[model samples]
Target: MLVSLEIERVEPLADGAPFGAVGAYERVVGKAKGEVDPAAPGNRGIALIDKAPRNASGKVEYTTDIFILRPKDFSRGNGRILYEVNNRGRKMLFGYIADGPQGVNDPKTMADVGNGFPLRQGYTIVWSGWDPDAPRANMGLGLTAPVATDSGRPIVQKVRDEFVSGTRGGALETFKLSCEAASLEQPRARLTMRERAGDEPRELPLNQWSFVDARSIKLRDGSKPRPGWIYEFHYEATNPKVLGLGFAATRDVVSWLRYDAAALAVTGGPISHALAIGFSQAGRYLRNHISEGFNRDEQGRKVFDGIHSHIAGVGRIFFNTPFGQPARTGTQHEDHFFPENAFPFSTAMQSDPLTGKSGSLFRGDGSDPKLIETNTSTEYWQKGASLLHTDPLGTTDVTLPDHSRVYMIAGTQHGGRAGATTDAGPNVNPRNPHNPMPAVRALLMALDAWVVSGQAPPASRVPTLADGTLVEADRTGFPAVPGAAVVKVTNQVAPPGDWVNPTPPAKAYRTLVCKVDADGNEAAGIRLPDIAVPLATYTGWNEYKPPYPAGELADRDGSCLPFAVDAAARQAAGDPRPAIAERYKSGADYQARVEAVVASLLADRLLLPEDAERYRERAAKEPRVAP
Candidate 1:
């Protein structure tokens, strides 16, 4: 396990800038080499591990990219490690949690680290590659894994690929396949197109497209791919990497750092506790890691003491199968039928009536870590988030274990961007830009305390059917706003299906959503100031434009529909909601209301003091009502 770590480069972070009392920090960039025993108890569950090529010692070898930032003087810093799972090989913890700049994969300057929140808190930030197919653009991190073979011979299998073009993608002439084609002449290959997920797929003539090479396909000159249309391809492929080794590699890396004193040479100090945080696609990886029992190292020691999964909803990653594409995920208007949504959605043990399977995310052993699951409103509408708290049949709420806490950050989109105003992409309405980072920052600190000192964090903040806040998707009680469409359809959850050759589900599982007030805002959840105080009617669902399917939910987008400026404007528009002027006497009145809500949130430990001040400053600048 973690046999060697080769340091490639080391440099002072931000040109030796001091971050509070922790002093200057150093960034270590290197490659981590590890080997796993297929016959070992902890590694046996990894798919295709036995089929992978082995070293001289009969152990499977793997190499992964590693990046870490730690205090130069380890004794003065917190003795904890904060590991952030990168999304698509790119890091986002700084931007999402520290209010830092977005899309900086390689950070060097002060601006790159944003406000340096993690450094000031004396955290040893760590990142490692876990996906073999992760993109290498922009210095993206990834693992180099061995392909599964049978007795020195290649293994071939049929794989399926799904692709959906964007609004401006109609001019696109070529699409890349996830796996290489076995031969140039593919007689068994079939290409089908569908208008929507429920519609029947129409087979396209073979003459319409031709294989550009073993790895990509190009459409004929006359045939242009339509936007928002689903395209499916089936072909024979070979050379499937042992992707499941990613789990073992992650476990081994963390285990070596915690139990091995030699790790201090890399970590800059001894790490007593390790916390893992993942966002979006990476978040789903954590669920799979826990469910697959990777938390227990080979030596029976815990790898991570705490886990924070954000925006993953009730799904696990499709990463442990043959020819698996870890980058693909199921969404409403795209990637509709993947193996992400499986049984045992909740943390507590439960039974799936369809498959007759009874289990939970936890292995029921003592290897479970303290879990903090955070989701945005978009997950409830597009990702089957209700199943995380409700039973499989959507009948009643399931109580979470003492070690787990779930919170729903309302009125935000999946990519919680702050200060979003204009409509972008194919959506008809303005996209939701309400930042949920303030709550995220606070919860991260709370999770660290719980793991370090055995202190319980805040109580779970989620809507429940017992309180009448969670109901059927159609019963959200939305107001009839002009030029706005209400959401009645959500992502369907069905029984697990075969990944390579999947068939249609005979029946579907019931899904629910969060109830909303008359103003079309979510009534229950961790309501930020933008939601607690009225500024606009924010919703987790947004409709696609005309070119796309009608009434279908846009992929992971939310809407922000502002209220009328005055009563006259509201009456003229036939809007039932109160006007801004009628709700507040003046601009100052609105700011006061926002301030009060922020103070309450701070007292509840749902917001940090720095974020509270940011909210006040933003509220004072936005004066929708007359002074």
Candidate 2:
């Protein structure tokens, strides 16, 4: 099904990589050379963002870079390619390293991180530049796109830009979205300020804010931007890039690599099957990619056999639109008005009773891939993950299709903290410390089995309304724990008009959080040993302390509070719950409890045996647990 594919070249990795016998090479996906091949219709698709004019070739030609890391010897490799789409500029391809010996921030042994598990497994890993604006020199792949314009005129659309800073809010109106152009004659823009997410937004007089460049918007007084306040500017932006092509690029590249048999000479053979994983923004991109019918190549062959979107809530991206800003991620405070959050947020088919519109996230092109979506506890609290499994009205559970599975990692933060302990991550996020990697590793294996061996993954472990497990945030059975705010997560809604303006959702969808047990751990989903046998009361929701959208979820980070060591301590803090010291006779007792929990998880197939052992071992090392 390939239009054209060239090996470009292959090179061995420098010494001291954790990849074992694996080698790495960079592949080049170039623009079409001769007549446009339908299968490699690089930019032939319509640009929904702008009715931009194109050349006689019919579409803009794009050339980009992709990287492959596989066994140097083709015979040693499995026929599977794990295509990990980058999230922004960072590589999560090795994030599972958090579960291994070398954790993040390992400069000296970064190559040896993750214990070479993926390499030893003989799976070939590949990644390509999808987002054109993804930092190239900053260690990200490169994507080049043709500029989009309307019939000889620059297409301009009202774009919303929001900036939040903890320390350095530069003094100037130079907030550029990727690469955009503001009007030359003093662009017209409006600025608004809100000290807290709950605070009433105060509109600044038009005279107060002006653009310094496409990148920055600042006060007319020339004062430095303040920390902890949200500065939002709504202005006319022009020259939107054909960002949606990035989606097609992913499809075409994978299709060419997986189906092009010519590669067998050097790479052994075309990959038998392919899978993709995207986290956060990239995850949302995947959602938009499949939902927008980009999973199939121009020749109509499936690109990805299986898809895993992680930490992406009820959102897609402003991927392809007039003045498109594919990088803008909608949040409660930052970029809060992007098109990422839209209807049909779930993969399950259900009618939006209000609009009487019904559909699922599948393309309906018969090329929909098997999907396995996973979210952390933070999603339920912040990202409306409940929407994935529940009806839009949130009154009942929407059964997942047999081909799709939804899993929620209990008591974890967004993307989960890596190598998390009872302590929170060093990053400023205040959420609890729940490592989602072990579960992620196990689920990926399940996804591979589902695609290769036709074995269904474990039954969906998401919370449900019928079971009383999925309930409103305020309804959680959590005891009155100190320093914990079981507050409601914002439900972003909108009416029909002025898509770019701040049109609040006319009505709120039913936002639900998971129910908790006596120990304050989520009881509905896959709970690793950390929650099953806990020392601290791990939580999915963490509060913004002072500045930075106060009272909102801490940008998806969690909070971990070790239960008071003793009942006296709990009583002094006015905590109604018992303490870890009171619950477990000693660390060994905690270890035994964790072991039992691990055994149960293994039996349920929620966790693999190897992962269960790792969990047990980690629990044993916790200061609260003894050998």
Q: Considering every candidate listed, which one attains the maximal lDDT?
A: 1
Candidate 1 colliding pairs:
none
Report the C-alpha lDDT of model 2 over 527-582, residue by residue, as the tens digit: 88878877777777766655344565455567776678777888899887777777
Against the reference, the lDDT scores of all candidates come to 0.86, 0.68
Q: Put down candidate 1 lDDT per residue, 1-627, tens digits, no spaces.
A: 899988899899999999999999999999999999999998988888989999999999999999999898898789899998888899988888877888899988898888888889999998999999888677688999999988779888988898878732344567888887887785678888998877888888888888999888877876778878888898998888999999988898888888898898999878999999999998999999899999999989899999999999987887888888888878777777788989888898888888899988888788899999999998988888888888888898998889999999988888785545557567778778788888988898889989999889988888889999988888988899998867788888888777666777887777788899889899998999888987788888888886777677888888888899888999999999999888888778888998999989998889989889988998788757677
Off by over 4 Å in 2: 1-9, 14-46, 49-56, 96-113, 167-174, 196-210, 218-222, 265-268, 420-430, 493-497
Query: What TM-score quantifies how close candidate 2 is to the native fold?
Result: 0.89
Give residue 270's lDDT in candidate 2 (0 to 100). 59
Once superposed on the true structure, which residue ranges of model 1 sit more than 4 Å away at CA?
167-173, 419-421
- The TM-score leader among the candidates is 1
Supply every candidate's count of residue pairs whose N, Cα or C atoms clash at under 3 angstroms. Answer: 0, 22
